[model samples]
Target: MFEALYQYQGQLLQGLTTTLIVAFGSFVVGFLIAAVLAPAAVYGNLLTRRIIMGYVGLIRGLPELLVIFLIFYGGTVLLTKLAGRYVEVDALTAGIASLSVVSAAYLTEILRSALLSVAQGQWEAALSLGFRRPRAFLLVVLQQMMVKALPGLTNQWLVILKESALVSVIGLEELMRKSVVAAGATHQPLAFYLAAAGFYVIITGISTLLLKAYETRLTPHMR
Candidate 1:
C-alpha cells in the first residue's frame, strides 16, 4: 500500500494542485460577484433586488451538474456563434463559472442576512455623525457585515471546493478524476477512493483551521 502510494505520489500531487487551483479560482471570482451582488440584493431598489432575486432563485433551483453542462457546452456554443468561429471552453473555465454563479446565490443570502443583522442604531449613529449614506455604509456597515458573515462565507467556500470536484465529468483531471483513473488502472477502487477521501479531509481541515484563525484575529475588533 505504502509503495503504491509512493509510486503515485507525483500524480496525486498534480491532481491536488489542480483541485486547489480550480477551487481557489472559483472562490475568488465567486466572492467578487457575491460581494457586489449580495449587497445590491439587500440595498438596491425594488426592481434591482427583484432581478437579483430571480437570478438567485434560478441558480438555486438547478442541479449543479446541469449547470456545469450548460456552462461548459452551452457557453462554448454561444461563444462560437457570437464570434463566428470555433471557441473552446475548457473544464476549468466551466467549473469556475458554474461554481461562481452557484456560490454567488448562496453568498448573496448570507451577506443579505449579515447586512440585515446590523443594528439600526449603527446606521442612525453614522448618519448622526454627518456621514452620507455611501460613506456610512462604506465606513461602518460594511465593516460589521464582513466580520459577521466571515464564518458563513468560509462555509460557502468549503462547499465550492467540494463542488469543484464535479468538474471531473468534463475531464478536468482534478483529484476525483485522478482517483478514478488510478482506481481503474490498479483495480483497487477502495484504496483509491479512500485516498481521495483523505485528500478531501486534509483540504477541508486546513481550510477550517485557517478560517478559525482568521475569526480569532477578528474577535478583538468584533466587540
Candidate 2:
C-alpha cells in the first residue's frame, strides 16, 4: 500500500486539487444563487417567488446525471448555435455550471427554512425600534437566520463535495476520474478505490471539524 501510494502520489495530489477546485467553485457560485433566490422565494413579490419556486422544482426533480449531461452537451450546442460557430465547452466548465445550479436549488430550500425559523417577534422588535424593513432584515434578521441555518448549510456543502465526484463521468480529472485512470493503468481497482476513499474521508473529516468550530463561534453567548 505504501509503495503504491508513493508511486501515484503525483496523480493523487492532482486529483485532490481538481476535486477541491470544482467543489469550492461550485459552492461559492451556488451559495450566491441560493442567497438571492431563497430570499426571493420567501419574501419577494408573487411573480418573483413563483419563478424561484419553479426553478427550484425543476432542478430538484431532475437527476444529477441528466443535469450534468444536459449542461455539458446542451450548453455547448446552444452556445455554438448562438455564436454561429463550433464552440467547445470543456468538462470542467460544464460540471461546475451544472453542480452550481443543482446545489443552488438545495441551498435555497435550506436558507428559506432558516429564514422562516427566525422568530416573528424579532422582526416585530426591529420594526418597533424604527429600523426600516430592509434595514431590519439586513441587520437583525439575516444574522440570526445564518446562525440557525449553518448546520443545514454545512450539510449541503458536504453533499456538493460528494456530488463533485460525479463530474468524473464527463471526463473531468477530479478524484474519481483520477482513481479510475489509475485503477485501469495498474489493474488494481480495490487499492486505488480504497485510497480514494481514505482521501475523501480525510477531507470531509477536516471540513466537519472546521464547520463545527465556526458554528460554535457564531452561537450566541449563554447566561
Q: Best-fitting candidate, measured by TM-score? A: 2
Residue 3, candidate 2: C-alpha displacement in angstroms: 2.4
Model 2: colliding residue pairs: none
Q: What are the per-residue Cα lDDT tens digits for candidate 1 across 1-223?
A: 6666667778878989999998898888877887898878887999999999999899999998999999999999999999999997988888888888888888888888899999999999999999999999999998888889999999988998899889999999988898889878777778878888999999999999999888878777654
Q: What is the C-alpha lDDT of each candidate?
A: 0.88, 0.91
TM-score of each: 0.94, 0.96
List the lowest-lDDT window of 10 residues for candidate 1.
1-10
lDDT (tens digit, per residue) of candidate 2 on 41-131: 8889999999998999999999988999999999989999999999978998999999999999999988999999999999999999999
Q: Pairing residues by index, what is the TM-score of model 2?
A: 0.96
lDDT of 1: 0.88
